[model samples]
Target: MTQTHPSPAADTGPGQWNPRLWGLLLVLAGNMLIDALEVSVAVVALPSIATDLSLPLTDVQWVMTGFAVGFGALLLFGARMVSLLGRRRVYLAALLGFAAASVLSAFAQEPGLLIATRLVKGFCAALTAPTGLAIISTAFPQGRARSRAVSVYTLFGAGGFTAGLLLSGWLTEHTWRLALAFPAPIVLLLFALGLRLIPNENSTTAGTPPTGHRSYDIAGALTFTLALLTLVYGITALPEHGLGHPLAAGPLAAAVLLLGLFTLIERTVSHPLVSLRPLRSGALVRSALGAACLNGSYLGMLFVLTYQMQTVAGWSPLKTALALVPAAAPPAIAALASGRLVARFGAPRLIAAGAACAFTGYLLQLRPSWPLDYPGRLLPTLLLVGAGFVLSFAALNMQATSQLPPAERGAGSGLYQTAVQLAAVVAVALVAALLAGAEHAAGPAAATSAGRPALTLVAVLGGLGLLTALTALARPTTPTPSVPRT
Candidate 1:
């Protein structure tokens, strides 16, 4: 069967460069970068924040996990909100909310107040991140233009992690408050430009249904929120309270029950928060698995490596950040170059290749040496890991969205982003568990011994992701014929 790809936006010829379209991409990509930047920027500033507020080490970490929990939990609900209120309206409002949260965070005198602000910012981010990608998918024509836009969008997102690390170090050196203050001005500026740039209508993705007047599904919203929040909280808490502890197992069990209830509600309700129909697509299922593995492996690798750099190698924050540049830079470059290649080789093969590279990177890092050599031992791992990101990240995002109709694009984006956040949470937990076990066994030199198990766990994750991507490739291929614009 030849699939006819129909784009929501008016198609300009391939040679024609539209300034307005590019402007929209810039605003959306910038928004994506800001959301991702928040996740990492605070990481380097946590110690400074802890000192200023006199918080315990364990409590201080909630400043980060709180944000991730809120961000991941509200995603599906946010997509439902976008369906009710327009995307343009939700996008701008979310940005405004983010700005306000940033200001509150800057002025917060207590840890409680600061954590509240972080949660608010995370919720707002949940609103904007998926909407930005949906906006791009709807604004660009289906083939080359959409592909390029996704590549650029993914590149900015990948780059933001590195940006946050560098910025946090500099800002925290001056004042940790500066790190908190930075996002307000940037978000407000983007909000202003977005009013002029983002498309006003609902046709932001391929199969988006017309938005007129529909009663909001409040039941669906509540069930979905409770389910996701419980799941995220359970996984994040696992590191603090061992997996056998009630704190870890209780919430996870409740999360499972709530999710089951949510599924039942969705099936029975006339209006659902998430339709399970689109999930039947093999491509989307595999892409979601690929996304899970990609984030899980990459983040887990970073978790163990950070310990290796700081605890074992005695590297300063500045030195660690600089050393990570090789691991971060290649993805951005690869993302830009990958649009054409994605079109030629297709997303599945590239995804498999990327996962394979990441697995190989982890394999190379499994050496249990006492004093790790950076150039001889670590540099090649970083390079391969970066190369793996370059290949898989954009392709995963693109493949997930490529087949969805506009109406379903919001759901698709929400699902993809949720996979990413949940994977990161799970990955960190898994690595933490492995590290804990290693430490218990190794006693005095636990730091040196922990790296091997952590890296091995990451390698296993990468291999699973590679297997998922290969399955996507095994699906029957059909010609994707472009539908001409009116």
Candidate 2:
């Protein structure tokens, strides 16, 4: 594919900010905040959901994993939809769908119905999330303005998870259903604003292939989605059922087969869902991997800690949310300054530093003595974790799409977000499995014993992310070859 550059006029610069542009940015970022909020708002309410619905830990976790599966599975397809349908149409439609799904989730009496509604919401999010980023990439100039815009966009995403936690804490006390339904009105408003603000032009720009070259790759999409779903199901079931059981073994085996088939399909497809060429870019891969680790570990930590505080520590929902504020609030404030930081110090360094901070925080929580100290120990850990997000979240978002051509930005965003959602799926599933197994064995003191191994796993994930970021920093930069005048 040919590389395309933004026209000089696209920059508009810092001095040329207009109300319309700001409105557009606000619309995009607000939608992004809602997409992110979906990931965590249900987290604090999970225990309540499980109890009210008479669910086990493994089953109730599907409330979380279901959304991730739907989001990750359809993201590439959503990018294609953006190219075919135009970003404005897709964004508005998805927002409407999200509102409807949120409403369905609120009234769902059966666990199956609830999980299905969550999946629908996730699919809507998959569409809106990448579409929002793609619109930003096309609308903003590729310098300070764009960087700052992306920082603000991502800041809301990081903060949204925190906001969700706080919201869930308050809402879940009365009913978990309110926590599930609250996003409906908010998203409906975004939909109304988006109808006006999102550009009408299709996301496909100069570098896009002709319509003849495009293919839906439906087979690949189905295969890949099923593979992920199966993998998650197997992992979630493994702790309770063990490898010998059909529930665990069947899905695991099928996942492997489906993954192999999906890879084959991607390699053979004309217009592959995800282009293989970009995967070769170390920076892109590093950004995706680093993001996956950061998100996965952070969420996994939250899942484990929520249980610890609520179950073991006997804390109220609101109190637990307040105590955990340090882990989410710092990132929101820090992200405001990240665009300048990325401009000055570069993304790799910040990513490494962030990973290190998160790893240290997780390490602090690894060996929690019974009767865990809140202020001295856990509080510091949350602060460090939040700091890690502050340092890395915006940098990761900026770096992931920085090198991609305009036409490929949507796909690039999809791939990046897919990594994030997949990471959440795996991390939450694994953490849930470990916690469930430990609790089953430990009985009354489940949270105390169960949390240690989960925390250790989170730390390991952080350590690996740190290593990946450090590798990116350590690698020598290669200059692009200059083309001689024809």
Which candidate comes out best when scored by lDDT? 2
Show the lowest summed lDDT stretch of 10 residues, model 2. 477-486
Q: What lDDT tens digits, residue by residue, belong to model 1 across residues 36-96? A: 8897776667656766888633455556666765687677777778877878789999999
Clashing pairs in 1: 138-204, 205-406, 206-406, 207-405, 207-406, 207-407, 208-406, 208-407
Q: Candidate 1's error at 76, in angstroms? A: 2.5
Tens digit of per-residue lDDT, candidate 2, span 50-71: 8799987888888998999889
Q: Which RMSD does model 1 reach against the true structure?
A: 6.0
Q: Estimate each model's TM-score.
A: 0.82, 0.88
Q: What is the C-alpha lDDT of each candidate?
A: 0.75, 0.81
